[model samples]
Target: MLTDVKRTPGEKAFDWLNLIIVLVITFIILYPLVFVLFASMSDPRKMFDSPLLFWPKGFNLDSYVTVFENKDIWMGYGNTVLYTTVGTFINIMMTVFGAYPLSRKRFYGKGLFTFLFTFTMFFGGGLIPSYLVNQQLGIVNTMWVLVLPGAISAFNLIIMRTYFQTQIPLELEESAYVDGCNDYRLLYKIVLPLSTPIIAVMVLFYGVGHWNSYFEAMIYMSDRGQYPLQLILREILIKNEFKDMLGIAVDSQYADRMIVREGLKYAVVVVSSLPLLILYPLLSKFFEKGILVGAIKG
Candidate 1:
């Protein structure tokens, strides 16, 4: 009963080629992640023996337990959650409001505003100047330093503006206007209803950026208690671990502990990555249509 599908020889050939290319690309991207999962689950000793890439040998959750036992790790987790959640909310608000006006052709000084936003995408005040500004504002060493300074990304604003202009129909806004719905009501009721996909994209982008950020915290926050997850992970994985990398001598008890702690590094990766990995599937569901709407539309 259904007969809309059609394919020519050339199309069939192209489809086969595309499928092969896609599978190859997927494997390339996933192989390292799969290796990390194996490394996390397998015995650290066994990992050194065969050096796994595809699967685990003697799977266990001990690494997870080790990661969770660290008080610093838990504190970092809590701080990261706070930063990511609050940052995403602020990002959405700023992006929506910033983009909405840009999308409106009737707005005065629209070109000037667009140019100003675009200018920031290419250049910024250097780290020293930015640090001084934060210090002057009294946000240095404070939690607000993490959330407020870089709340609205210019690229994300542009993407949202493009999405709003392309996907949300002008006639829908006109209809609302005729119904005596003001600009604010039209945006809150109508524009936002169709914007779930784009909003999800922004949330994923901003949330991941905020969660993984460490350098900002290292510069802005002098207090270890206020440090986000990535900064703590850096201290453990890179700074401490680097000292032992030149083959820690077997005679040193400290070296043995450092090697054991190396296993803990793998555990930390799995721990910090788990939240974003869980979030990715949900976020990916919104990406397909959102990318097309935001990118391909006139």
Candidate 2:
């Protein structure tokens, strides 16, 4: 039988204090997102006039209409999806292959190899040299340039190697070997099947990175058609070059342009970030478990 334990007065007070602090912090963190959302939906003139930006100041959605109507926006969206899916797949594959060998006890020169991987975390060829190399390889404007170069992240590899070491037992491997399973067979058939949580965590990490990446695309891709969603959105935000998106005539009133521009400003952010927000909740449990599993024994 379990007994209920009573909290001390101090403990109860501390709990209340923590609750208040959490609420305050939550409000602080969420307010900007809320503000942006409301601003995006609000009538620009009314939104500015409102004293407290708690709600939409007379709902408007011309900005969203402007964003969605752009063929380039759709093209960039497709490109971002392609890049994210391909890049995350490559990241997971490379990380798994790199990590698995290191995780095995029989692997040769593990420490030196691990050190070399870690060394890359600190030192890198600066941008100009990297660009020259990519240019020389003739992949400057290619999909391969974006996905292949960043295939394996050293930090993620270490986490996965540690997870494999701690989570999968030596007895399991020995038993598999006794059954005449080769290393590749053991990995493909048994280890991978059991590593879903870590894999999901890796997916979220790499997926988000690819989804949000813009600088690399901007640097490597001169072809506007090949530009990722983030790079396209950056152009929309910074350059305000949405005349092509505007359904109105070029001579349409400046006031109409301003209204659409105001909404588009926040709409772009919402469109870019909404997928990631949805993705996180779906992977949250797996992410928590995988990260803890890797860290506890690491």
Candidate 3:
């Protein structure tokens, strides 16, 4: 025991109470995830009867098999993967370039350009007008429609510009300029390497947005084959007995499958989320630093 800092009995009791409070809060947040995992594995009938139980009853792979067997589900997964990867790449590049010039005070037409971009953030053409634009552009009824229309999100551009303004030192650009490096060279060699965290943050943001999109697909596409994962998942969740809008009958087996499909919905949630969930821990290291680095002073 050191003479300098002995704790009184009351102080020790407070520490124990704080530890208990923290553990309770942790359990409150985590219990729902744990419950979902249990429900997904448990027999559906048993799950309904005792919905709050902690353990599976008569656990089986039937739900997993049922979800996997749905052809649209697999296709949706494939489509989502392609959309997230391609969309994230395009998002990152466009945001970086857009941010770069806007960060500079001397760029020609900077105010006009910035106002134009920011203006879209607060307003937009109505849905019908936007659809007409997409149709005119020939992106409707095509895979590119899913990937292109809203490619450069305005909030992301503003964040990226703000980041560049606050974080990249002016002296670094001046140093590169003295070496006769072009703008592209300075950006690729100096700015991008130091901007990994923000880039990763943008990737997560845009990638998830693309993954979850359904409304644009609903209005713009006529082909079932072109439906993205969320639309397909919507069919599984809510369209079990509903006729196709074009007057097609819902297959009878589709109704029979709902018992297992309920569980499969949870399984799909796990599957749809697996990539981001796995990537998050890896990306979160960059994510935290990114938000902090540029925002602290600004």
List the pairs of residues colliding in candidate 3. none
- For model 2, state the Cα shift of residue 90 in Å: 0.8
Q: Model 1 segments beyond 4 Å from truth?
A: 1-21, 241-256
| Model 2 segments more than 4 A misplaced | 1-8, 247-252
Candidate 1, overall lDDT? 0.85
Counting only residues 3 or more apart in sequence or on different chains, how many pairs clash (N, Cα, C under 3 Å) in candidate 2? 0
True-vs-predicted CA distance for residue 52, candidate 3, Å: 0.8
TM-score of each: 0.89, 0.94, 0.86
Tens-place lDDT digits, model 1, residues 2-121: 988888999999999999999999999998888888788876766777754577877867777877767888999999999899988988999899999899878899899999999998
Taking all chains together, the TM-score of candidate 2 against the true structure is 0.94
lDDT of 2: 0.89
Misplaced by over 4 Å in model 3 are: 1-25, 241-258
Q: What's the lDDT of the predicted structure labeled candidate 3?
A: 0.80
**Candidate whose lDDT is highest:** 2
